[model samples]
Target: MNQFTDKRKGMDHKDLAVEARGLVKVFGDNRAVDGVDLNVRAGSIYGVLGPNGAGKTTTIRMLATLLKADAGSAKIFGYDVAKDAQIVRQLIGVTGQYASVDESLSATENLVIFSRLLGLSRAESKRKAMELLEEFGLTEAARRPLKHFSGGMRRRLDLAASLIAQPPLIFLDEPTTGLDPRTRNQMWDTIRRLVKEGSTVLLTTQYLQEADELADRIAVIDHGRVVAEGTVNDLKESIGTSSLHLSIQNEQSLSKARLIVERVLNVQSAVTAEGGKITAPMADADRVTDLLITLREAGIQLEELSVQKPTLDEVFLSITGQNTASNTQVKKEELA
Candidate 1:
């Protein structure tokens, strides 16, 4: 086997599909990317989340070989990105924040062009284009011009074009930016499908729920550095606590329910009128069952109740002290 093949063969003991250390980049006087380290495993989705100007795009660009990092190193499946960029390119596909398809071309035409560029024969390209168009629910609109396609359809085509060669790794740079809720959900489904088929994906997004829903692990970046990195539960637990939320059937019941919960859990409960919801800190995991039994014995009828860890929005605000409201779904124009 060649040396590159040997290095990959040695990867049987390595858990990471992508690895980087002390990555940095600069644009004129601005340091777009600071020292950043990343380790993403094979066959899983890793999310990088941040607001605009957070260096997410710059980091991904370095990993994808579009831009070189000024310092440190990056590797994909044992291939060094800077040194073996061509080999690394052979293993990865990238879908940027903006749709990469030609606006005047048809969906099938776009995908076929991509497939052909990846070294597929014309006939093979056509077959692969047909398959991807069907997979991404674009078969009916396969022959339709890109201008006629909706924003969502075009986004799917961009994604479809990237997968033309079925590269094992994918870098999705804000894949759902500016998409409607339904269309974003559709894209989420497509991402899950990609992971199910054994693709490792690096996804960057400003949407908090997008990372919470899709990522096996997430790294939150701000001001060009990763402030936090972990699974959803891990990050939530870092600066926040889990809580029990209960809604009483009647407003009058909230008063009684609050007393029952506080007495049973040994914590104060705050009652809110919005949903007749009573919220309390959950210090002990086992007390949830006890609280339920205590409320039942006191004749409290709950309209709704559940235990929840803190949301990603809360974590983001706590870490950066920045208003989550200011983070809009950004386009490529907004990112560095």
Candidate 2:
């Protein structure tokens, strides 16, 4: 076997698909990635979340061996990324924000070419191409040139191309950035399936919902550093386990209601911008009953009330203190 093959053999069956420590990358005076560490468990979905220009892509490039790190080290399936890049490349696949497929080629033709380049037999290439096209719900568009495909269709085809070999680890950088809800959900299902079939998915996204839905564990990156890392529940509980939300029937009672909620719950509460609803973190679920009783006794009639676990949006804001959607969009446009 070749030296690269030998390295691959030795690194096989590792429990961590990706292990990165103190990874730093600098572009001139800009330190795009700084002291970031990540550990992605094999066969699980791990999300890297950040706003635009937050080093998410730069960090992925270093881990994928597309870019060298300025400091620290990383390994893919136990093979060092810098010293064993060729072997590491064989064990991982990457799908970026933009499709990498040939625009002039039909979907079937593109996948067939990728399969052939990966060393499948001619008949096997065609079969794999068709199978993947169908699996991605692109059977009808298989014959259409990619230039005519919609953004969502192109994204799906790009992901399908990456899976032709079913590499053990996949890096997805904002795979659903601009996709419609339906297309985004479809991509989510495919990502889940990749993990179910034994591929480790390390995806970077700006969408809170996407990370919350797909990631078993997440690392929240901000200012080119890992600000927080843990399971979804762990991060949510870091701020508060659950939240109390209520809307009062009387507009004037809103102020009174906020006071009662804070006093009874022993936590600060925020009123919505329109001065209609109040929201507070709930430390003890039992305290919810006390708050409700206090509000009613104080002559505040409730319009709506519910206790819900802190959403990933809340978690991100609490950690980074930024509005993800607004900040990401402004920064993304600036980057472009």
Candidate 3:
């Protein structure tokens, strides 16, 4: 047996809705998805985070059965993705960044059409549509064309359509990419409800905050490989427990203050975008008290002081050296 199989020998594979191993896909000599493995527990949100070109979308497509893996194996609910693609189709729903709701159709019309296509009777489809429209807070706008809906409303409608069958597993590819803060929060609430109702989700996004806020477990991918995998706290602890941050009142003393902090703490300092400020990541909070005394004796003239820790954004910048825009462009199209 392979190492992965051996490691999972005694575990319940059914508890994991997604188990992919050594998944590889290439495009024109570019290895879009390298030897990546994923294990997402059922009924939890598993976030795939990376900058652009990080192979997140490509890997997701493979698991969704929209793209075939060039190598390795993937299973959804113990059904092989390649050998049991038809069954896979029945088990999952996909909602991309762009809402797929028809622009010409009203909210009610869109959901009804999808439900009908999924084989619901006319009356059943209409009933399902109304339920979802109200669940998604589109009841008042049910008769409005998708073109008249705001970005967030359209996305909610898109998600509503994907749920026409209430599949066991769902794939959400950046479901809140360009949404406003309030709308993003609304979408987050919907996703949480899905998990509460017993649906497993595989969400891929470039938004670090969204991942931090939602994912039960997270995997950071870069250059087609996973560089880190763990819960939010686990990843933060890997970087550092917490850090001390302060802002200088006097611009002239910034350089002198920075040097004093580095020499006493023996850790590098990061300058934030806010003028006259510096940050240092440290494990012990007690150290901040000592640093304060030393800086006081030196008369650094500090304006602000606080204790903080590393965030997921720092984790991505620390490891990948890029932002969400660094995602992969080498995707395989079924052009043949």
Candidate 4:
């Protein structure tokens, strides 16, 4: 056995499918990923979330063996990422942020070509290609050139190509970034199917909803380090308190409503005149009924009132002090 394979055998199978310790990357003077660590459980979907330039792509590339880190170590199924890169490559598949499939080839041709490149026999390649096409609901248009396919179709093909070798680990970088809602959901279903089939996925995305929906665990990275890591509910609970949004009938009513909410709930409240709205965090859910009663008794008419949990977007903002979408756009521009 090769030295890489030998080292991998030393680790227990139940250990992480992918693990990184004190991972750091530097470009000139910029530290892309600084002191970051990750532990992705076998067959679980782990999401790396950040705005653009937050080092999410850099981390993914390093794990995929496309980039070497300046410090720290990463392992794929017990194989060192830097020292045993070849073995790591064999054990994982990567789908980059942008579609990498050749536009001139038909969808089936693209998958078949990749399967063959991975050392499948001609017949095996054809069979695998057809299977992937059917699995992704692309069999109807398998013979059409990729250039004619919609953004969603092309993305599905890209994912199919990555799985030609059926690698145990998959790296998906911003897999659904520009896709429409329907297409995006379809991709989510495909990812779930992969996990069900015992594939471990490491996904990076700018979409908070996507991460919440697909990831078994989430790590929020900023400025090249993980700022928060946990399940979606765990992260939300850490932020503390649920927000109550009230749309009062008029600006005057909004002002009164905010005061009442603050006084009765003993919490901070803010009122916006333009929207005639009052928003505040409620420490106790039991206070909701009292809040309504208090508002009505005070002659404050509310057009709408609702209590909502903090969304991932809100969590990102609270942790990083910036919006995830805006940061992602800035990073894209920089990369372009």
Candidate maximizing lDDT: 2
Cα displacement (angstroms), candidate 1, residue 321, comes to 5.3
The TM-scores of all predictions, comma-separated, are 0.73, 0.77, 0.79, 0.78
List per-prediction Cα lDDT, in the order shown.
0.81, 0.82, 0.80, 0.81
| C-alpha RMSD values across all candidates | 8.2, 7.2, 5.1, 6.8
Evaluate residue 4 in candidate 1 and report its C-alpha lDDT on the 0 to 100 scale.
11
Q: For model 4, name the residue pairs that clash.
A: 52-328
lDDT of 1 by residue, 1-336 (tens): 011111233445256879988899988777778888888889999999887777888999999999989998999998999999999999999998878889998998888888888999999999999999998899999998999998889888999988887889999999998899999999999899999999999999986678889998888877677777778666655434766788878777778888888898876566543666777767687988998898889888888878777554445545554433334434233244
What TM-score quantifies how close candidate 3 is to the native fold? 0.79
Instruction: Write candidate 4's Cα lDDT for 273-307 as tens digits.
Output: 36656766555788888988998898888898887
Model 1 lDDT, residue 243, Cα: 66
Tell me, by TM-score, which candidate is best.
3
Q: Which of 2 and 4 is the better model by lDDT? A: 2
lDDT of 2 by residue, 1-336 (tens): 011111122433467899888999877766778899888879899999877778899898899898999999999999999999999988988897778899999999999999999999999999999999999999999999998999999999999999999899999999999999999989999999899999999999986668889998888886678878878766666557777789888898888888888898877676655646787877788988888788778998988888777764555555655444443454432121
Where model 3 places Cα greater than 4 Å from the true spot, the runs are: 1-10, 241-280, 289-309, 317-336
Give the clash count for model 1: 0
